[model samples]
Target chain A: MERVLDMTIQEVRELLRKKEISSVELTGFYLERIKKYDGSLLTYLRVTEEEALEMARDADRRIGQGEDGPLLGIPLGIKDIFCTKGIETTCASRILEGFVPPYDATVIKKLKDRSFVHLGRLNMDEFAMGSSTENSAFQTTKNPWDLSRIPGGSSGGSASAVAAGLCAAALGTDTGGSIRQPASLCGAVGMKPTYGRVSRYGLIAFASSLDQVGPLTRSVSDCAVVMNAIAGYDPMDSTSIPQPVPDYTELLGRDIKGMKIGIPREYFIEGMDEDVKRAVRESLAVFEHQGASLVDISLPHTEYAVATYYVICTAEASSNLARYDGVKYGLRIDGKDIIDMYKKTRSKGFGKEVKRRIILGTYVLSSGYYDAYYRKAGKVRTLMRRDFDEAFKACDIIVTAVSPTTAFKTGEKIDDPLTMYLSDIFTIPMNLAGLPAMSVPCGFDGSGLPIGLQIIGRPLDEGRIMQAGYVIERERAVKKIPDTLR
Target chain B: MKITKDVVEYVAHLGRLELEHDEVELYTTQLDRILDYVDALNKLDTEGIEPTSHAVPLDSVMREDEVRDSIGVDSSIRNAPERKETFFKVPPIIEVEE
Candidate 1:
């Protein structure tokens, strides 16, 4: 029965359908695991014990009434970034501490419609800023595989929660590799939907254009199942696409014969870990064995991705975060005057990284430097997008490493922001291009850390990446549960 | 490209953030390093390229000018740091004639 906590959402779905287990039992199992393991992992910022159990009881009643939704009663974790009605959503930052949203995020609404029980709000980088969870205003979420190492961020808690078996699956946001990078480091399957696929209405703003919601699950099929529930059009979100949502699970186990997989030369650059490169190359061969053709390709503008991403993201962040004045929601430090109030509140509320980014964003968007920095970066972003457009023309999917290296030790790169930023180099371009990408566990490094192979598809083409990922997932069906849990 | 103390101070002011003296010094050095790294963008020739605000080309997103129910004052003010009735309380903006 303890092994029930390790089952995927799909497996749990069948168990509920067969009446072998009630939703209450399954939810309680995960809640118990979270209670036992979460103290060391620091995966959950808040465990919605009452809400989750109450929802589970309702789910059990629905199951008894013959309800047949895939996510019915499945316990999952929500990233602190998304608004849950009456649930505190702090975006792992002090600025939003103790703030509970009055309304549910659109994603939360959709999942609730499917009767998915949320375990709690998972920890993340402060306002989804840094690469490692160390930037969290609360406790750092450690990697489930190696306790001393960091679980990647800003969705570190989501990945770690799933990997630690604390939740059946978890929801995360990826503005710049927040979902996939952490998924890779934690050895879970994570998929970032196309930018506008999932509505961001209740999501805490980080860089409006780049921010996207995704799922980190134990398997690709589970990712597809979660996507089916969360992905679609929404009138509430201005950026939500009107395209019809497909049954993401429909494309699973589809034949990949004659599919062209591109290996972007620029992504395989200098200083990338040899183990990561080797593991990714080996997975390409697995795809080739599945009758897919691998072609070497180029995204020449890849070098400019990080620089452009920083400038544009920070500029937008500055504008979006300006709404958090002294009078508004969350933290407020009163001062002698209004101006002083705003300054004091912000300076005291935001973490060091958040403040640094605000300063950088302000400088870039300021009167004197807007043209040289912001506009130029935006233009370079166009060039980077063009590189993807050209490369995608020759391939069905692009294969690359999610990050240059696996999980680094905690406090290793927290002080060096540049090196920390570079950790998401490979995953950043896909976000900038608004394409769907998935990170699937490929193999392990010498230190037994998991390496992730990134599968990138064109905009609105999550099906293709899932189809390709399904094959790799089948061939390399290695159990990656950390020894800590065992 | 050299981010000096004045530049850091001015940026912090524009960002509406108060920085202590040590923070200013620390930020100046850190920003200098990051800005120097980001200077790599200047190497590319983006002469005629149009800046892309969004990855996808979205037409003007306009909804019908119809009234809809909002969360209203109570729920909206639930998270306010300081609230009075239905309004969020804040420091006064006007300067009295002394």
Candidate 2:
């Protein structure tokens, strides 16, 4: 029999329903795997072993009472960015080191209602700031595929845990490729739902307009199962749409014939690694073979995406993060007076990357430079969105490389911030456009590092990407178990 | 956008962050490069384009003005660094005359 840790959510759900395996047994099985492996990967900031077992026990009782939900007893990892009432939710920054939110994030509330087991907070880049997990205030999370390489961030820990089966699946937030980039690097499936598709009420703000919560799992189907539970409108989030939610799993395994997949010419530009290009191209070929037409399209504003993203994201971040003063929740370093207290608390609390972003954000929004910096970037952002509007007119979904290369060594680009930012060049545009995109394991490089292929769909059209990702996953049939775990 | 040390200090102050000398020096160079790189936005002619603060055009998000149950005082103050019986405590905002 396959190890319970390796099974998908559906497999576990079936086992629980049949009474062959209890929810506590399943939870204990994953807790053992996490205990045995998490120390080496640094995937979890804290493992809620007792909480998970307790939740599992409750789920088993519910099962006995004939209550069966899709995620009734599944164990899942949550990125530290979400506020889980009474549980530490740090965003992996020292400022929020001990913050136990007064309320659960909408997604957490929904999942808890369905009786999902919380496996504890996953580590991330401080304030969800960097491409690599190196920016985390705590320890760095290593890629399960290659221990020396990094798990991509700021959802790095979530991706790492799912890739190594430390948790059956995990929830991750993506502002700009945080979910997809790391999932690609770690050989797991990650999704970024449309903006406001999932509520942002209690999620730590990174780029409010672009920030979204999604899932990282071992298979595309598991991503759909998670989506059904988390995606919907919430009165708490003003930005959430009032559209009716659909069962995303209904679209899976359906024929994708005649589906037009757009291939943006800009994404295949120079400097993309040779192995990455070949792997993505090979994956593209699989779609063509399966009757989907590939249309070459252009997002002419691709080059401006990263620059615009940094400007707007930082500007919003500056405004959003201003509330972390010492008087309120979280860490405090006493100073002589109120002003000094604010300065001391923030300076000592935030990591270097968080500080840099705050400073840059403040500069753009500062009096002298607002027009030339922030406004100009916003106008260019409109153009970037239009580029997708025009491209989608020609195609239903877009296919692109998730990152320029596979995972890099831990300390490789931490010193060179621009180089590190460029690592997410291909994945940033989708977020700027506020679309739903996903990363699926395409293939492995010669060094055994995993590569990710991004599938982007129209706004609120997560179903298409999920459908397409499912086909590619089945066709490739790639079983990726990281060396460390094996 | 030349990010000088003085400018770094000014921005840090605006961000309410206290930085040491090395931080100012390091950030000046790093911010300079980042600002210079983003200057490419100047190349495009945004003559009449409207700026987009958000990707989706959300209408006014209004809710009913009715009182509802909140987390309440105790839960709200649970994570406060320093708090009194029912409120967060902060350094005195107004200095009393000596």
Candidate 3:
């Protein structure tokens, strides 16, 4: 059982198939780890121990009957943003504290169909809003590497749990840098697929246009397995493209003998940490050594990304979050009248960051400022996407630092919203362009926090991104269980 | 160009959000700074460029107008914080002005 914790998803599948271990025993091992480590990590919002065992039992029975699924019998963590049927799915926000979904999110359903076992719901920034997990109204998730520092968010718990070996892998959402940043900071591999690759049918809307569900896992190949399960066209999400899904794993072990890698000039500018820059530059050098020549590319519209994302995402959030009126699902506070009720419920239920975004969104979309702020941001989004489209013509993929720095200490940037939003500059451009990007662990910073190499691919070209990421993971990544866990 | 308290209050009202007085003051300064940061977009000329509402181009998705199984009222109202006989209960929508 202890050895199983160190194995990748494929290794565990081999063990499970050869009758070497039952799903029940494997899940129990993970449960014990969670029981022991979660107290210090605070990674889980809720651990559905009984249901996990029951699911594992079901998987065992199916395996006994000769059923083989890609994620069969494997236990995984779920970020709270993905709704689980009859389970309390709080996007780490108080507003939805007691809300239980009537149906599973499409991604959740896909994983369930594959006989995957659910470990529990992981913590995140409220409504996937903050860069650090401190914004969760529940408890702040501690970094598995260094407990005092934050696990990057809003997928903080997912990354931390995977790094700590609490679960084989975890599902996370990336609206901005939520998935990749945390994965980078926690020494895990996280991908934010193309915007419409996965179905958004039951995902709680943040920035509807930008919100995407991806995987955070222990290995790059594991990321591919999860992506294969979840990435598909769903008519349920009208915005979902009709492109045929490719086997993401096929690109692994792929040779990039003559591939062109792009290094955007804007991403390497001032204010980036020396260690992070060094790791990224070294990663490009590795690609060059493998016969992948590096091109000096420019995504000149990079600077406007953070600002445009704020305008766009907040506006969409303000609109999507409007459904959280006191009368309907979620928390409701009584007031003298209906309008007063709405004000009280939202004001009290939402966290500070959520409230701030709602107001900013409202102000931007307000009558007089509509053309100046919201509309202008929209046009700038076009320019940003065009910047990528042009850059992609020059190279197969783009590489950059996942975040300017590794994980900062808890409460470092919570109070200062401006400074906090700027740290997201590196990750926001991908969201705006609606391209697939991933963060594969490149190296550890001087302080031992993990550094991630951001790989950007053409729209719907997650295969190539994984190809490069697999190379980086194989050659450079130093993923290991932190000593704290040992 | 500054985001004044009144503007924040009005926008908050429109968003159906109520902020404490201190929150209003704090958001006023923060929102001002954020809006100021985004003010850089004003310098670029976007006269003919089209706005991208969705990154992937989308068209109206026409589906067959057919009845199908949907979540029943019982399940739909299961999460209502305040419910009255399958209806989400709320405070009175109409009240006489004081």
All candidates: TM-score of chain A: 0.99, 0.99, 0.99
**DockQ winner, 2 or 3:** 2
Tell me the deviation in Å of residue B74 in model 1.
Answer: 1.1
Clash statistics: count for each candidate: 0, 0, 0
DockQ of each: 0.86, 0.89, 0.86
lDDT digits (tens) for residues A417-449 of candidate 2: 988988889888878888999999989889988
Which docking class does model 1 fall in?
high
Write one digit per residue (lDDT tens) for candidate 1, span A90-205: 98888888898999999999999999898899999998998998989989999998899999999999999998888889999999999999999999999999989999999999
- The fnat scores of all predictions, in order, read 0.88, 0.90, 0.92
Off by over 4 Å in 3: B96-98
- Pairs with steric clashes in candidate 2: none
Interface RMSD of 3: 0.9
lDDT (Cα, tens digit) per residue for candidate 3, span A1-486:
888756779889999998899999999999999999899999999999988999999999999999997899999999998888988899998889989999999999999999999999999999999899899999999988899999999899999999999999999999899999999999999999998998988898899999999999989889999999999989889988888998888989988998999999999768888999999989988898888999999988998998999999999999999998977788888888899999999999999999999999988889989999999999999999999989989999999999999899998999999899998899999999898999999998888888988999998889999999989888885866887687
- Model 1, runs deviating above 4 Å: none
Instruction: Pick out the ten consecutive residues of candidate 2 chain A with the lowest summed lDDT.
Output: A1-10
Model 1: colliding residue pairs: none
Poorly placed runs, candidate 2 (over 4 Å): none
